[model samples]
Target: MEQQKLEKLLSKMTLDEKIGQLMQFAGHFYATNNNKDPVTGPDDLQVSSKSINYSGSVLGSAGAERNKEIQERYLAQSRMKIPLLFMADVINGFRTIFPIPLGLGASWDPMLVERAQTISAKEASSAGIHVTFAPMVDLVRDPRWGRVMESPGEDSFLNQEFAKASVRGFQGENLQADGERVAACVKHFVGYGAVEGGRDYNKVDLSERELRENYLPAFQAALEAGCELVMTAFNTIDSIPASGNQKLMREILRKEFDFDGVLISDYGAVEELIPHGVAADQKEAARKAMYAGVDIEMMSLCYENSLKELIGEGKVSVDLLDEAVLRILNLKNKLGLFENPYRGASIQKQNKYLFCPEHKEVAQEAAEKSCVLLKNNDVLPLRGGKIALIGPYADNPDILGEWSIFGKKEEAVTLKAGIAKHTSDYTYALGCPMYDRQETALTEAVNVARESTHIILALGEGSDRSGEGRSRSSITLPENQLELLRELKQIGKPITVVLFNGRPLDLMEVAELADGILEAWHPGSVGGTAIANLLFGKANPSGKLTMSFPRTTGQIPVYYNAYNTGRPLPEGSTERFYSRYIDTPNEPLYPFGFGLSYADFQYESLQLSANELKPGGSIDVQVLVKNQSDYSGEEIVQLYIRDLVGEVVRPVKELKAFQKVFIPANESKLVSFSITEEMLRYHHANLEFKSDPGEFKVLVGSSSTDLLSQSFYLK
Candidate 1:
């Protein structure tokens, strides 16, 4: 399918057919209803038989055989015989579920994350999925937002790196080349993660400088990596909905970033514009979306019903409609769907790829690396001791996080089952329900804890408590889980709390009650095995936290790299006039890049190759990391920089680069990082991106709070 052929096909399309190419709906719209009633879901978007016959694409449909049947039916009716493209929300995995994106972000291994996406692409393409709405590259700092689980973390640089990795992994080097690949759609285009009060679909208000500085970098990185599609956010940016903002879509994304990819609306966002008070009716909604550069209306009938009327009244131009349709045709041609309608979809390939043993091994490895040991008190590595596994998730298999549409919970191994393989001397007990207290369950849990030498208390939010539209005002453990912990503490046994959650929690109480805590954030299919290995000294935990765990819910947007205030509170100071909290400290309970290893690591002798750096020159900073304990483990050596004086106030510390290094027991390794002039650049008050001649401080350590510092000058 060449450009000339695509243009020729476009030239022959009728006005109705061209408009149909810009509409996407679910496959259920085309399904026959035995009652002969019109098919309707939660929304009032009616799908007529004519709309189904001419629809260009289908959403939320899988299975090679089923997709083939739908495509055949659609092509038989389409005047131009254009094949229907199948897309789904294949965020993490299709069948062989990997850890959630937040957990993968904790691994801090882009190459490993890329491999996981490659596996996701392989399984999804086999199941007849041509595109995935994934690699959500939103920079999140608020833990109250449930969608934070879908993001990488708080840093712009880390999110940018993972964004590029996801794009390369999904689309591969060449989309039309050999290997199982699906077109990647990097989503929530503009400041979706900065919703007011950390609520879903809330308003987002930020200056143009803040938008470009904090929000737009990761999206620009995704576009630079050659993502094929872009999805708009549901929220409003500066009082204008992102789906209908002409300046954001046309000027910044098109002219500035040069992204020529197809821009589609988030689920039913175009029709919701009327409620947003931006439009008076469906016809106005369709006009605004098309004029603002939204090429496709997802899960909505606004475009289907109003575009033709608007065009007839001379409100909308035929050329704008043709351009949108051309983008769709271009994407289909790029996917090679114009030639082979089936692409990589086949029942045979689905059987061979989905949940294969090799793919399972990668999931296991990812699960192992993603478990972060947040606190330890010499109570871990239950070697030859009778264990008590107690909680709702002790024997449950719903550990797979949200957005894993194709993964089966039954196939996932439970924690009790995995721990049983290590030792048969372990006992199990359901302490309580996920969110409620049960007296009989608590009594049985206490009896079991009294009979065991060590207790592994599994607790946290359920799978449905977080991710997309599941925001929480309080990010603490449930009262039942906390009460159970208090009751278990009186048994006088050493307890290790294993937390399975999607977002960072307020662990101040758990930090005091439990002897040890491990943040096992919704470890997927092989999660139980990975936890078992880490628990019984079979594997070492190396993951670091990407987001900050606050001391309380009041510190919603807490992160390590925050700007200094005019009146800053001194460390350990209780001055009332200074900027300090009376009830809680300004610092987080656990800082970003914070994690513990079985083997203790020590940082020593921070050295710099040069004391000064000139424009276009680089300086080498080196630090010696030693495994002080008699156990081998991996360490994430973090490098942070601070501009002591800047044209605009800078953060206290910003993570520039980090390296995950493996050190043998009682051995030392030298980790070196080259800092270039680009690393020192920042957006000035006037939005000028350049470096200033000033003194800079470099810090090297395992976490943001604990660091060894040195100074250098940038000239």
Candidate 2:
């Protein structure tokens, strides 16, 4: 009945109304060069304002009062009295901030991720936000890519689970029925993560097989989760930009996938097509983007100016205009905006839920689980030591990184504070600025490091250095910081390096110099407490790397799950054509699904209940994991599979399933994973998902690069 009403209303809408529906302008705010937008009101048109026309929707004008004011303006001033669809970049939080998505992924718990996003939606929707730009389901492989922190790591299956959970979390049971929930958008459709050289906004060129196999799964998973909106990528899929690629946005995303949701553009992505040289100008960029299926223009006025002229010149069809408007109206109707344009106007509720205690508790847990122990040499669990906490990030709260829109840095517990709470005597040195190259400052840092019993070197790229538009050609640690570490190592104290980077850095120096290294990738509000907990033996580090850490920027676009070339390497042979790199090893500094704990875990005795299985048959594969170390800690035992040969030439290995287990000192548990025929299936040459009857090797291990294996057969 609601669908019928939407259709009838859409059909009755005049060409101007349809065009108005298709057009979306930025709210009275702008993201400056620094990627931060200043808060503004609807009437504050000093920057640049639309002519009081109800262009289909508005973006970035969140908050209960702000959205209500915008809706009121739309209702009273517009010729057609249509309510505007309100959207905001509710990435991780609206009021209460959680750990970044990568940190949340470390928990390896989908339900937890869902709950966090659910809380985010509850807070966002209560504040008059009808839609959230969330579930950035880009399949990231490059750890150097700043936005890796925003994604659910590099695994397709894991990403699928998180994507689905996030959609359910955001939209709740149903948009129309759940008035407090907002519409969720799965973003950066089709290969935004595989940017060349791990640089943001770079090109992507992968075979179609790779795209369907690895890249597109999460996006499809989001759609399956009942997501009402899709945001196109800023990067190119093939030769064309994703925002303007009709084949991707129209032919595949719409025609083939049958996605009926409104396809919104990334922030200024439609306008960027002009700079991409595909579109001659902003007018052509707008025409191409709309024709390619972008329903809403985010932070770009190109659509508002170009759409009317394009339709008048017959450059764009009126039917497509109607379709775009209808989709927007359909989403608005589903969100119950027609019934209550100010549904989210609840200042009392916002005050209640924003930075709630329950949300902070969850954020702490997420932060704790997300702190990946990259390397430990019995230097951690710092129970009794005169520790020297040295770094610009040690006492600074701004190291919380980007997309933490609502997160108050002042509220963030600094590592210095957390350490002080845990230990009695500690000295903190500002050291060199995160990206600064000063040696005089390093002398003071070195003096402080030498005075302490142990030096805790907080290192890596600053928060401002690793987000979108903050891309760097060099991903190595700053020279001065590296020099400070080198000097600290000379002190001969047990040096523990705690990294507060937004993305993976080339930490070969710190990895070699530091006695212990903790990859604490900008864990959110409770990050300091979480790091302290892990350092003081209060909490175990169970977090794993979602993306591979590249040895160098040159060896980028690397992942554990990759296809074997025709010239396959024969084990134990150093042949030339067997898919080998002469200069560099075909491995990462740290592989995906990799992490460490204070305790050591030994995996032994791989047991399989059955060797052969059919489509419906099930097999139980078990491995005994013993905590050899004195410390009690948790370990995530990962399961992977490899088909020796296939019609499509499958990856050398693929992650199938995993289980995170906690073990007490000197205890063992038999971890088991059940496999069915569905788990073995994949897209064939015809792109159909089915498993072939063949021998398969099952690998069980702590990380992708370190595994123990056994064989099985599907018959």
Candidate 3:
């Protein structure tokens, strides 16, 4: 659609019709009779029939036939014959699922993450979805937040990289929205991940510097990558509900970030403004949301029923309505919906592409690269010995983590199934029930363990335990599962534990008992295949911890790169006055970037090109990485830099750059990084982003705790 045509079309819509453009209804709103006519009406809805008939968009995933029928009926009855935009939550994949976003973060390869989203776009677009609410891109440090499963991890720079990759993968090059791709929607605007107490939809209160320095960068990166849409958060930002926060949305997001895309409310957040105390009712909610720069009201009738009245009474500007409608129209046009409303949506395409082998291969590889080997005492690479596979997840294929909406658990292969392909000598039994100990089941598992030469135990939270409203006060393995492990430990056989969950968990007991541990964080779809291969030495665990694994649940929000406190605990000191926990250690159980590989890697001396970094010039930093083991493996070399003196107190060390390299057995590789003035920028107390002239430290390491360091000057 041309600019002139879109403007002219907008000029002709009535008040009711124009307001309808900003109103989105879920798919159930337009139930149709077999006669291809909508049998449902706006009787229950507060909006008039005209508004319901002219609703601009529908939310939900449906077959091509159903979407086509809905669009046909909608157009036939529309006064302007406008096409209805369809959107769905296709975060990981529509059907051919990959690992959850956090697991994708652990992969730490943005290009591979990009490929996964591209495949997600392909399958989702085939199902008549024009937009996907995905690539969460929120920076989460707390594992208690269920949607941490949706974030890349705690680091801002890594999240930024994944955010760009996710946006690019969904929209593709040139930002052309075609049948093969769905427009990407970067979500929850700002600071949804920093919700207090790690509770869902909790209030977010942060200083301007904290918000900008740590939280705002990733959203900026997504916008820079040309994300087409932004979703408002369900919680309050600076005490104002995000959908109704004018300073945050209109000033920060719309102006500061310069995002000119459509801004939609997350689910029913628009109406929830009343509960947030910012709106008196739905009408006030609509008024505040519109003024605050929300273009589309999702799953709510506020915009449908009250906008016309507000505009008529001069309480709200009709111009804002026009602006919102135009943005929606522009997005629909960008998606090429005007040219072919039913593009990329066909049962034929769905049958040919969904759950196809090529996509599953990608899923398998993603799973392989995403599983972190946390501990291995030479018990991995299981030999030709009889195996006992026991646990709730041993034969269960519900490994598809939460928010994998379109994926089917029955279609996924289980760890038992994957191991069976290698050998039938493995005996399997129940390692207790999922949440409790069944005496009979535990006895059976112990008997099987005694009969076998080794044990491959699978355990973790159920899929429902860590998504949306599923927050846990105690982030530990279920007591029964731990009891089962304690029982199996008496067998005195080497045990390898495969952890299947979404967020980082307290693994102290499991770590102590298991000879080896594979942190398989809900490797999706063909995750079983990846797990099986790694157990038998067919594949190597290359993934690292994007989020820190706490030693105990008390360290709920633990992360690397924290600020160096004034009374920082002395290294190896148990001083009482220092900032130390009385009971637990200060460090995480496994710090960020921590992982073990079958192949051993050694880091050589750190090298720097210069002692001082001058303005507009860059200093080259390098480290030699050597593989000592016989197996060839991929290594993610991470670079961290710390500002010794800043206008504001800086983090102890922040991840500035990283590279994923594959080295052959007994071979060495040089991992290099270039540090410019821009890389040294930080948010001061006044919120200015610039570097300070001072001493700095550069560190290269496999993880945050294990590092080789050197000092430099920036002038």
Candidate closest to the true structure, highest TM-score: 1
Local distance difference test scores for all models: 0.90, 0.81, 0.88
- Give per-residue CA lDDT, model 1, range 1-715, as digits (tens): 8788888999999888988999898877755422344556436656767777778888888898888878877777667988888889998789999999999999999998999999999999988889999889888889999999899999888899899999988999887774389999998988999999999999999888778877899999999999999999999998999999999999998889998889999999998899999999999999999988999899998989999999999999999998899899888878888888888889999999999999999999999999999988998777677899999889888889988879999999888888988999999999999998899999999999999999999998988989999999999999999999999999999999999999999999999999999999999998999999999879999999999999999987899888999999988999899987899999999999999989999999999999999878999999999999888999999999999998888999989999999999999999999999999888999999998998999999999998999999998
Off by over 4 Å in 2: 29-52, 281-287, 312-315, 437-440, 565-584
Please provide TM-scores, in order, for all candidate models, with all chains considered together. Answer: 0.99, 0.92, 0.98
Which run of 10 residues does model 2 get worst, by summed lDDT? 30-39
TM for candidate 1 is 0.99
TM-score of 3: 0.98
- Quote the positional error of residue 351 for candidate 2 in Å: 1.4
TM-score of 2: 0.92
State in Å the error of residue 19, model 2: 1.4
What lDDT does candidate 3 reach at residue 30?
61
**Worst 10-residue stretch by lDDT in candidate 1?**
33-42
Off by over 4 Å in 3: 32-50, 175-177
